[model samples]
Target chain A: MSTSQDFPTRKSSWKRFDVTVLYVFDLLGTFAFAVSGAIAAVRKKMDLYGILVLATVTAVGGGTIRDVLVGRVPPFIFRDITYFFVSITAGLLVFFFHKYVERRFKLLLIMDAIGLGTFTVIGISVGLKFDIGYFGAVFLGVMTATAGGMMRDVLQGEVPLVLQREIYASACIAGGLIFVCLDILNIVPDINVFISAAAVIAIRMISITKNWNLPKPKI
Target chain B: MSTSQDFPTRKSSWKRFDVTVLYVFDLLGTFAFAVSGAIAAVRKKMDLYGILVLATVTAVGGGTIRDVLVGRVPPFIFRDITYFFVSITAGLLVFFFHKYVERRFKLLLIMDAIGLGTFTVIGISVGLKFDIGYFGAVFLGVMTATAGGMMRDVLQGEVPLVLQREIYASACIAGGLIFVCLDILNIVPDINVFISAAAVIAIRMISITKNWNLPKPKI
Candidate 1:
């Protein structure tokens, strides 16, 4: 569906584009992530500000953790205001549309898969930018895509799904390899982003649909 | 008051006059911090394992953040398993005694103040051990004391009380200064710890009691 079709009649529909769709995917990911955070907040019966805090962490905590681990100073969300804007916007939407959003949790999960793929690729890109080893890049991608959710779960008092679930982090690792392979093929950078992201999203969605999982330890 | 009177009885609660209380105090702070985290987790309606995550973050997050900022490798909590052991024990207590604990919200705040004081000093000490300067030391100190709570609040979807209240952070700063002053005075290190910890605990307790506040921004 076209971006315009997604919004139906909203004026901001003009912001829609194929390239921006990548960003929209990211934004949708941010929104769903923030909603998960918001749902945790609601469970906590937090005030509006508290909800926003949870929303912000759910939106950015993984990236922030990844940055700190890579020894980046002050992390991007702290350095650039754009991330803050995205988080706040997402948080407000969650605050207003929580009921409707919760009813569509399954659809949001699919959108989350897309966002996860995009982030996994971004993580690999960042690792390469930092001259990290391939192993390090894979680790960074896995951490970047999932740590925020882990952090959100931890803060909300849940065991991180990534810790126990065999497929969640493994898929990010798979996508990171796809990114590495594409990079080795000398693909155009923009197409690389699209291909890697689509790969991750596909892998994740298929795995979930088919109940495909990495072998679990019998213990 | 005897350690038994004000704090929970841990293994071998009494011995070694000077350092024992401080270690116990650290444990006390850890317990209170972990409890607060667990309460927030419960508020979020998380499962059993989730409570442990919240508890651990609440207990160690502030110090871990401070360590990263100061370029410390391997956060102190992870380097020593003592913290995890203590945190989990505290979490179990919270899980079991949540009802009774909730009734003593005000008392818990007092314990939290003591925690703020002790952990701030501990963070500063950790920074100085790395040969960090006074500015960096104090900064880490405050971060060590408050960041975990902030993370807890953010994850639970609440505006961090630390940011909202002046005394919350101010107490850590004041305690950091006290640690510095005693260090400069060439006072015995053990005496310094006692005095500095007392200074923070007293100040925080007073601030909360009086509802002390920083002036609001004129803008």
Candidate 2:
């Protein structure tokens, strides 16, 4: 392992994205996921505490798992208070205005896609930092992008959405592959992150609009 | 943090139990949990692959989460080939003998309780080694005892049994407290672990036999 002095050199090409910028994207993704969780909670008519727990878990659960798998102790969510507040705020907003938000399902889907894209980029970057192999990195990326909503669906007594025929996790995997390829080719750091995230978002949007799905196994 | 020469002192006193003993109990617990998961998959009428997947996850899921929280990467199940084989064997057994097992639900419940007890002990010991505080240790213990079953229930599209009226998690918590207190009082390590695990098993058995339940929340 290299010392802090060698940290910059050791970091991948995606490292150039400023921490502040990454933090902002993280919060945006968190908020979007939290709202998705809150909407599910409302549909179940869960109490306030249940809604908040679901929202918080949906926002940070995947990242927590990612951090743990990469041997990062005391996950980022514990270190930063902002993530907690953002998730709670999103939950509160949805709780108070769920009927209005419910009518704007397309808007929610768009926000979720944005969250998925950004989270995939973040997961890839973090996984690369841990120096896990490309396959492990891509697996982590897909896990980060999909685990939260999958958890939410499971908690609500349904098969995970990711496990069903959907382009959701596939989009994240696509973004991860793009990021890994770009980094390997020594692309500019900011461009690598942007292109990867954009790819995920674009794919998600296109799939939703086109009603795209992976072929299902016929029993 | 210590050198290999100081490894023994760094290890908890509970480490006196040889790897063989620990491995045996771990495999036993894994088998029990795997059978439980297979039963759930059978109820859902999932395919053979789904049944195996559910069984594998249910056998190792709680321990995986516990390991992650303590910054132990590449969980114990991955290191031990026996755990994997035990779980798969159990799942296959259930797949073939599900009707017989279903008719003997009491036996299945007993096996599950044994798994729960042993897992709680393992979680507490690992958490303490990580120096996470007694509260966190107990929480980990309860989580380790319950989370796999909870995940299985959720994956099968049901409210988690732990979340409903059952003395399941409470027994684990109680056992954790006992272990912590005994350790603080300088009790012999092996005895402490035995007592703690036995307490959990006893409590769980009594609860089942007595029809004990925690009061449900008023909806």
Candidate 3:
């Protein structure tokens, strides 16, 4: 636990292209998070209010926690009404058509991937926004991608997988690094977001499918 | 719907007291909260990490949210170590002795009442700390008493009750008023905390047992 005095070093990067990519990825990641939230609520036999809370947390929980961590005031939820509106609409749709959607939707898997990837990139972007170095970006990226789930679990009275499952947040960390690399190469920001998101989603899917996991810390 | 201007009016409470009893009630309230969190985990078949998260959130979620609302940075989890230790110990005890405890423990019922009551008082205390005024104090009080449960639900992917379930929160509002009245009379702060806590606990128990509840809002 090094204090702020020993801020981690980051590679010199961040051309204009990187920023543009981040913006695109951010939206995709948010939408994916919303989908995941909706699915969780639908599975839980929750009423409308429950669905709404789940959707809101899935979409914004990550950033809300991140904002608090970075000393940003009130976080992004209060910044715009669009975010909330999007989550609510998503929740309503999930509530009304959950059974049919769950059976038919292949998009959920894609959304999960995109969400993992995009959120990782967004977290790194937040790190850059606050002038944090590379390591900070990686840390924030993981936090951003997983904090929503952590919060979602807390709200649902479950333990967050982030603390127990090794690979859960590792995907985001990997994607964040890719984002840093893309920026250094002066790639378009939107492209950077896509690439980073892809990396996380793929890695996560592969890890899960292959039963890859980190060793648990011994007591 | 009310904007920033409403915030000042909301917080305009002037009930004065020594502000010490608040501490005693707050401690008892925290303990009760811890019990609730741990019990929920037991009910849900959550793993150890789940138990830890639940215990922590139940103990501190209300206060943390209140602090955030008042623009107090880092909240109580960061402010002191006592809460962390207490929550963990409570969680471990619940996990290890849940079966024996479940048979013998009327503790949950009593603890829940105390938790609700203490939380109601604490909420107003936070409002007063911020000098948010009368309406604000009660509003905050309700939020404080219930936000942890809301968080608890969200984590389990359940819908939060705070946005609905008028009766539970309204009791807190009433409790805030009771505390404010005592404050205006310049009651001893410790006594004020106890009285206010008592009012909330008693109200919760009576209301729940007798099926007392606020009128449902027309959707």
The prediction achieving the highest TM-score against the true structure is 2
Instruction: State the displacement of the C-alpha of residue A16, model 2, in Å, after optimal TM-score superposition.
Output: 22
- Each candidate's interface RMSD (Å, one decimal) is 9.1, 5.4, 7.1
Better of 2 and 3 by lDDT: 2
Candidate 1 residue B157 C-alpha distance from true site, Å: 19
lDDT of 2 by residue, A94-204 (tens): 877777767888887887888898888777777777889888888988888888888888777777878888799999999898988988898755667678888999999
lDDT of 3: 0.67
Query: Which ten contiguous residues of candidate 3 chain B have the minimum total lDDT?
Result: B1-10
- What is candidate 3's CA lDDT for residue B154? 62
TM-scores of all predicted structures: 0.55, 0.59, 0.57
Would you list the C-alpha lDDT of every candidate in the order shown? 0.71, 0.75, 0.67
Clashing pairs in 1: A44-B43, A50-B157, A50-B158, A50-B159, A51-B157, A157-B50, A158-B50
Better of 1 and 2 by DockQ: 2
User: Between prediction 1 and prediction 3, which has the larger lDDT?
Assistant: 1
Q: Where in model 2 is the C-alpha error above 4 Å?
A: A1-56, A69-74, A77-150, A158-219, B1-24, B68-73, B154-159, B214-217
TM-score of chain A of each: 0.83, 0.90, 0.78
Clashing pairs in 2: none
Which candidate tops DockQ? Answer: 2
Q: Model 3's CAPRI class?
A: incorrect
lDDT of 3 by residue, B1-219 (tens): 011111212211442222333444456567667766777787888999998899889788877877775667667677666777777887888889867656655566666677777767666666665666655576567767887877676666555665444346656667888888988897744567678778887777778778765432122
